[model samples]
Target: MENRSDEFSQKLLNEMNALYSLLLLFFYLITQIIAIYVNFCLVVMVFRTIKDEYKYPYYPLLFLIMFSNVLFVAMTTAIAVLGGLSRIVPALAKSFPVLIMIAISYPTVICVLDFLLCIHRFSVMFWDSEFWSIHVRWKGPLIFLITLPFVVLISSISITYSSLLVGVEIDAFGVGNLPLYCFISDIALKSLLGFLTFVGYVLILLRVAQQNRKVGKFTDFTVIEQAFPIACFQLISSILTVFMHMGVHRSAWSFAKVCLLKYAFTQLLCIVVPISIIIGNQNRRKKFRYFCVCLKPNQVEPANHRVCITMSNNRTSTTETSF
Candidate 1:
């Protein structure tokens, strides 16, 4: 009786494993394709459709963030392809440790971009000086310099953490060799980022709310208001994903499923987040819609001539003013 029970348990586990392998493959492939399309469209729009006078102060950051997404998606797409193929050619499993290593740094880049934007907005509001304004043209080089140390540090930590992990070559999912740990470095990075971005988002929201409530509010936080949707999405999603991951923190089928869920949420959020940033600004959306329809509007509206777009429980209004 004991021997029969052990055989049955083993068979059940095997059957379930087979089922999940197929599900994971489909999930990875489908999400990667959708991400590629959405990010590609965003890249084109940012470069081609943007009006010169649309002086979105965070334009450089926004562009860099979207472009970073493009690179991240491209890397993930490659991971999905190679992971899918590794099943047939078992030797390919060796490279997953390296690939996942490279892929993990992508999110750190997003965090850096968000932090820079948030800090810049905060500086503008609090300092109210020509500090950031004076070096607007040098924002690119300035960001690169500021973030280089962080990127380097994160990469080193991730590599060290990956070495500590004992990856499974053919886990229940039967894809590439999977990390046995719950992506410890990734969780740490997200946790740190969650804290920083939370502070930044709260400050931005509080300041924007105060400004909006003013009588004839002349100097509203236009940049923060415009970046709010995307920033909010980033914060919410990061918190949720970290919570979800904590629940399934082990090397098992549940762990694989949890990771898959994270990736799915990622694909959805990446597509929505950039669009949210664009939609936050009314004039930009107008030109975006026009460009999508393949019609170039002869007169492109500028951001200085503001068109306010606000939503309160399904209500929206557009109040024009000098931004």
Candidate 2:
């Protein structure tokens, strides 16, 4: 009886592992498809807007957001693909550490970029003249340069700690296990960043809402529409990350399950937000309407103007006779 029980338990475990492997492959394919669609849309939008001579300060920030999204998709897809194949490919299995670092770095950079984009939009709407001044642009680059070193230093330290304490080990069948790193510290940092981003975006949303209330018109819905999707994506991604971190520390849940959930949430963001932006543009709607109007033939002009003038002259003559 004891031997039979052991054999049955082993068989069950094997099935679970096989199921998890299939899930990973499914998720990887879905994310790749979404990423390709997003990249194509971004390219089209950028090409359309590139020749505009107006100094729309937000263009650069939009471009940065799109570029970051592309990077996120590419890096994330690579991680998923390589991670899935690590069981079959020894080279990929060994390079898992570097791949993990790249994955983390891509999202970190993207988070920072999202914050900057929100701040840039706020500055443009509230302080248009000041934002456009030459001093602001020059100073901005200097600030980034000054801060770049510190960001690199911090990320490097985190990466080193993560690599050493949480290495990946692969079995002969290509299954990989990644240990959790930074325990309390990682959760705290991620929570802090997530909270900060959420707050910033929420405040911006409130400001826009307030302005819209006063104006009784939404002059530009593009920013508002895009902001909500981005905020939702950021919030969901951050919360899932924290949850994954906690799950890693607990033995009750499988690490693979946590990773699958985390990546699934990420796939949601990569698939939904950018696509919503492209489809929801108010300007694009107007342009489409105008195109339809132009395709039709023009109608004849009204004779009301000439008739009104003749009626006015006759009224003048009648008034003179009555006097």
lDDT of 1: 0.58
What lDDT is reached at residue 121 by model 1? 72
Stretches off by above 4 angstroms in model 2 are 1-16, 75-88, 91-98, 124-190, 215-217, 250-261, 284-323
CA lDDT of each candidate? 0.58, 0.52
lDDT of 1 by residue, 130-174 (tens): 545445435744765686576745553544433322132322232
List the pairs of residues colliding in candidate 1: none
Give the TM-score (vs. native) of candidate 2.
0.62
**lDDT digits (tens) for residues 1-323 of candidate 2:** 44543443344345456766687768767777866776666556656655751155555545555676777777756665666665755444444445444444444554555555566666655666565433333444454446545544444345443322233222322222222233344445545655666676677677778888997766464754665566667666777777665555422125435545655665666666566556556543333332331123333333443222212211322112111
Q: Choose the strongest candidate by TM-score.
A: 1
